[model samples]
Target: MRRMDTKTTTEKTGETGDNAESPEGAGSAGADIAAKTTEPVEAAEAAPAVEPLDADALGPADEVDKDDDEDDDEALFPDEAPASASAGIGGAAAAVVSAALGVVALTGTWTGKVVAERETLIGQIKTSGSGTPAQQISEIYADAWHSVALVNGVLSLVALLVAVLVLALPGRPSWVRAVAVAGAVLGGLGLLLSVGTYFDLFLNLPTAGS
Candidate 1:
């Protein structure tokens, strides 16, 4: 039989037996083992938590902010920002300007109008064979020239209006400048002819004895 006796060499106050130790020392040893294991585990968790910087807004954070699921969802859906209406307004203005330019190209300049007149003439030829070929061609030119003249007159007035309205608009358009140029030249040429006709320079000359 094995037994712990009171007078044994391992049980006396001056000895420290293998299986018998003071309560305070045992508690201290256990606490040390727990602390060592816990510390290393915590350190291991901390080491790999640091993430490199990336462009992904939904990616993980730095080591210091190692909160897992809570913050990731919050970061992904940030606060709502206001939309810039001015951007839309600017884009719309550009579109309006492009459309106005297209109109001018079709109807504003002499060359543009001449081209359109040619198209209309071709259409007329197709629809109604109303006259001889030479007459049809002559009527086409006549109609086109008259339209050019009237357009010039209207554009002259519009040019003056544009100068006045330039400061009033939200912004200047590319078409406005081009229209102004065409309007000014045609208007000036007509004005000069009107002045000459008024001063009798373009009047009919009298026959020798009539």
Candidate 2:
């Protein structure tokens, strides 16, 4: 009977210890699970929110790129610069031409000499048949002189008009303007001389007796 009682006491002690250990293990597992679940939730709450990017915000790099594109476009076309250069060259040429025409008028031209000769021939033919000595001299020599004067006057007038036109144009170079002024002055002088010669104001016709 004593042996049986001892065995029964030992079995009861073991069952009581097991029940206490089970409750402790269960509490530790529940605590670990709760910590793991709350860790993810706290991290989500602590993280910063993301914002959308603004479309209209341009930085310095973007502006630089835009400027480079514009410069490339100007290089590709390149029309305006050449056109202006060509216009300047044309104006300079016209100024030179006006000056040359003025000089030609002041001097004598082959065309003027040819015209004078033709007029002289015509006058001689007309007066050779019937005319006094004074009439013949007036018709032949005076007519030829007037014809040359007329040709020179026309050339001078043309030069004067061209020079005036060049002066009236805007944005001419300084050298071009100076040359044009000279051409105008020479043309005016030539025209005056031509007029005087044509009207016989410079040298009158010889008398029939002389």
Candidate 3:
């Protein structure tokens, strides 16, 4: 009977140990779960909040970037800018040339004088032998005068046409247009004078009999 009681007491002690160990293990497991949940919540709360971007705040920066890109493009293609400038310079030069031609037509160029002298020499050769005095006068003096008038008229016409072409073209500068207009006026006046001289309206030829 003493041995039986001792065995019973040992079984009871083992059951008590099991019960105490179960509660401690359960408490430790609950603590671990609570710690895991609280750590994640604390981490989420400590992290910085993200804000949305504003369009108005970025507008000036975008515009500045666009302007810089345009400037870079201009720098890369520098030759393109000068092409239009060269064209303008060419137009201006053409206008000046037209004006100069008009002045030369009015003032009588060396070419016109040389042409007149050549015609005079030709007339003298043709009238050397048996032409009448009237025929000689017409050949020598009238032909030479008409030749000069013809050359002047041609030069005046060229100047007038060039000026007209410049005026007709689009996008001419103010100074170019002004010069072209002056050239046209001068050419027209020169052409009129040349016509009068050619027709003997300005100066009549001397009578052969006289």
Highest-scoring model, TM-score:
3
Per-residue lDDT of model 1, residues 160-205, tens digit only:
3443344245444566544544444444455444344334366533
Q: List the candidate 3 regions with Cα displacement exceeding 4 Å.
A: 1-18, 23-67, 72-81
What residue pairs clash in candidate 1, if any at all?
Answer: none
Worst 10 residues of 3 by lDDT: 78-87
Q: Write one digit per residue (lDDT tens) for candidate 2, span 1-210.
A: 999999999999999888778988789899999999999999999999997866556576788889999899889987757576887888788788888888999997998899889988888888888988987887788888998999999989888988898899899999999988988988888899999999999998888887
- In terms of TM-score, how similar is model 1 to the real structure? 0.25
Q: Sorted by lDDT, highest first, which candidate order results?
A: 3, 2, 1
TM-score of each: 0.25, 0.69, 0.71
Q: Which tens-of-lDDT digit does each residue in 1-210 have in candidate 3?
A: 999999999999999889778988789999999999899899999999998999999999999999999999999997776566877888788788889988998999898899889888988999899888888889889998999899999999998998998898888899999999999998898899999999999899998777
lDDT of each: 0.52, 0.88, 0.90
Ranking 1 against 2 by lDDT, winner: 2
In the order shown, the candidates' Cα RMSDs to the true structure are: 15.8, 5.8, 6.6
Question: How much is the lDDT of residue 17 in candidate 1?
Answer: 58
